[model samples]
Target: MVTRRWWQKLYHRSGSSTAAAASTRTISPIMYEFEHLYQMAMEEIGYAIDSQTSSYYAYDLEDAQAAVQACIQLYNQLPITDKWNPWAEALQQLQTRLDALPLPIN
Candidate 1:
C-alpha cells in the first residue's frame, strides 16, 4: 500500500489524472479578472502590434494595456509557470508599441 502526496503526482510513475493536477496557490478575483483581461488583450494586441492594422481599435489597446499592467502586478506575486508566461509576455510586450493612441480600426 502507498500513500502519495499531491506533489508526488506530477512525477510519479503512475498514470493517474491527479498527476496533471497543479499545486497552485489560491488567487483572488484580481488574478481571474486579470487573466480574462489579458486574454482579451491578446486578441486586440495582434492587430496593433504586428500589422498596426485597422482591425484593432485605440480603446481596445488602452483598455487592454491598463488590464495588462494590473495583471502583471497580480501575477508578480505568483510563480511564473508555463501556464502564465506566454500570455504574460505578450501583454508585457504589448506596451512597446510606439503609438498607444486610440485609432479607429475599420
Candidate 2:
C-alpha cells in the first residue's frame, strides 16, 4: 500500500472546492536529496576507490558503505514516474560501486 506523507497531505489540502487539483513537485528539492546523498558517499568512498588516494586508508569504510545503502533505499522508495527516470539513472553508478565493496570486517 502506498502511504501518504504529511507534506503530501498538506499539499492536497486546499480551500477551493474543486475536489482535487493537480500539482507538480519542483525538481530542486528532489535533486537536492539525491545530490546530498551522492556527495556524502563520494566524500567517504571516492578517495578509497580513486588510485591517487587508495593508500590513504581509513576505518570509516563501513560508514561510507552504509551511506550508499541509504541512497539505494531512498531510490527504491521513490516513485518510479516518468519525470524521475533521469535521477534514477544518475544513481545507478553509485549503487554499482557500493555493491562491489568487500564486506566489513567483524
Number of the top lDDT candidate: 2
Q: Each candidate's lDDT (Cα)? A: 0.48, 0.53
Cand. 2 Cα-lDDT? 0.53
Residues 1-106 of candidate 2: C-alpha lDDT, one tens digit per residue: 1112222432364546322221234444444455555666666566445533343333445555666676667666655562366666767777777666655434
Q: How does each model score on TM-score? A: 0.36, 0.49
lDDT for predicted candidate 1 compared with the true structure:
0.48
| Candidate 1 least-lDDT 10 residues | 1-10
Q: What shift in Å separates residue 24 of candidate 1 from its native position after superposition?
A: 14
lDDT of 1 by residue, 12-98 (tens): 534343223222445555555455445544554554455445453454455445545645665666555534567656655755542
Q: How many pairs of residues collide in model 1?
A: 1
